[model samples]
Target: MPSVEATGAKLYFEESGYGYPIIFIHEFASDMRGWDAQIGHFSRSYRCIAYNARGYPPSDVPEDPQSYGWELAVDDIAALMRHLDIEQAHLIGLSMGGYAALQFGLRYPERVGAIVAGSVGSGCHPAHRDAWLRETSVPSRIFVEHGMVTMAERMARGPARVQLKYKDRQRWREFILRLRQHSPQGMAKTMAHCQAARPSLHDLSHQLSDMAIPVLLAVGDEDTRCLETNLMLKSELPNAGLWICPNTGHAINLEEPAAFNAQVENFLGAVERGSWLRGFPATATIPSLVRSRGARRDHSLIQIDQETEGADVVRLHLR
Candidate 1:
């Protein structure tokens, strides 16, 4: 009853509050419950929805690997919204879910109000394509062979995730506990069909360039795997702004929920007021400057300046 049918599987979902919708999608290692911090905060002002992907428990896991794919994840979001009678909603996702949010923005611009993508672009660097594929694909075999228990042990000690362990032991334990509960078959299918097979963000330059949706890209300074890719995302997406959290790692939201919530709340406000990017996007202005014929923009649409010690913490708002 709390599940919706997608192409080849059923997705279990949860909804809270009552306002303009906000859908929270999870990362590869996480499930719908992973968004508890976000949903708990945003639900006070917005209709918040979170769901377990097709492979996660309570959601049907089709035996057919054909049942899962990267694009299908976006389709699932659309299907979920349609099933709920929602024409459009804001999308907030972390890692894999972040990629899905961007893809959904590209595919159905009409269906998205805005996008907040955190710690996205892991294997998107051109040079890392082959290696990233190998890295991502290997997890499928590992998951299928040793099971989630062993996989969880290995992943809990990952370089980027160590920050979580040191920063919040209890939280890190919670993450690992949930990870161990995942189905090996579902995880294997997900790693193989969804993550390993997904297209690189660099390859989507044209679509990203043409995308007019407002985007907020968040990453961690210690998340070396994603820094370059997030930079690329900022460059390719016209109305994109980026924030780099100093000393943080892969899981930006989980690592810094307080800061994350505050920043996202401000971004959502800006989006609602139609002031996120204002009239002229920075990318559009560059060409305008090259032409040097058009009148300069008198009003400040968006301002970019480094306030904190970290220059990568990009903060944008109408002045």
Candidate 2:
């Protein structure tokens, strides 16, 4: 039960094994246990560190929503790394955590060795941002009042749970119940932070191409929410590789942890060994929606280049 005080919040974190550091940050409303599938496997080969976001389990929550801005969350992570004397470490973040990690990397590239930005995008696409705000904000009321149970039930029914892998109905029910036990206020605060988040990432995108550290941008192919933006990010990131998990949605890591873990291992290995250096997005292409004010609503159908196996591609049609 390791803990650190940062940004007026006490963060709860866990550390396992001993090797090159790898930190896992959970998405909004999720505690550190959301990364259960990763901690065990990676700990055997590398240092695995997972932590609860501020106001989530094992952490403090402020009554004021403004206390939990993205900037503060980013500072919390930076402080955590510094407190641990970790000058550089590999980062794995999901959903909101992914957004935080992307921001962290952009602001402090030298502090990160590599990054696995999972189930998230670079925020360059307006549609992606709108979709995220709408989807996450839609559940703000239920989350703030009833906690994660309602949210988990809806998530369990999403495309990510296609062909359920649960051993039995009882287990699935229990999992959902556990998620329900998550803090309501914590999630509401997170949702508010997301609503206030800025959509532009030009500065980050510019810094991305210059970063020497390797990066992997992964998301579910069925995730219409972030697909457009993820692909946009892949085109701008300097040394990033993209992976789209098939039969999944926004919760790619949770739905296909095995595939997600394998891709992460490969990305980390390539980064450390410096074996693969081929850069994606040979050139940056601006989406017409942002370029032309009077562009038609339906014009180009942008298809995600799903060169990877078992990965789904989401197409965006803009006029």
Model 2 weakest 10-residue run by lDDT: 299-308
lDDT of 2 at 205: 70
**Which prediction has the highest TM-score against the true structure?**
1
lDDT of 1 by residue, 130-221 (tens): 99888877889999899999999789889888898999999999989999999999999998999989999999998899998989999999
Q: How many residue pairs clash (N, CA or C atoms closer than 3 angstroms) in each of the candidate models, in the order given? A: 0, 5
lDDT of 2 by residue, 161-251 (tens): 4334442354356556656877778777776675346445543676666666677989877776678777767777767788987766666
- Local error of candidate 1 at 73, Å? 0.5
| Candidate no. 2 TM-score | 0.79
TM-score of each: 0.88, 0.79
lDDT of 2 at 95: 73
Clashing pairs in 2: 149-180, 296-319, 298-319, 299-318, 299-319
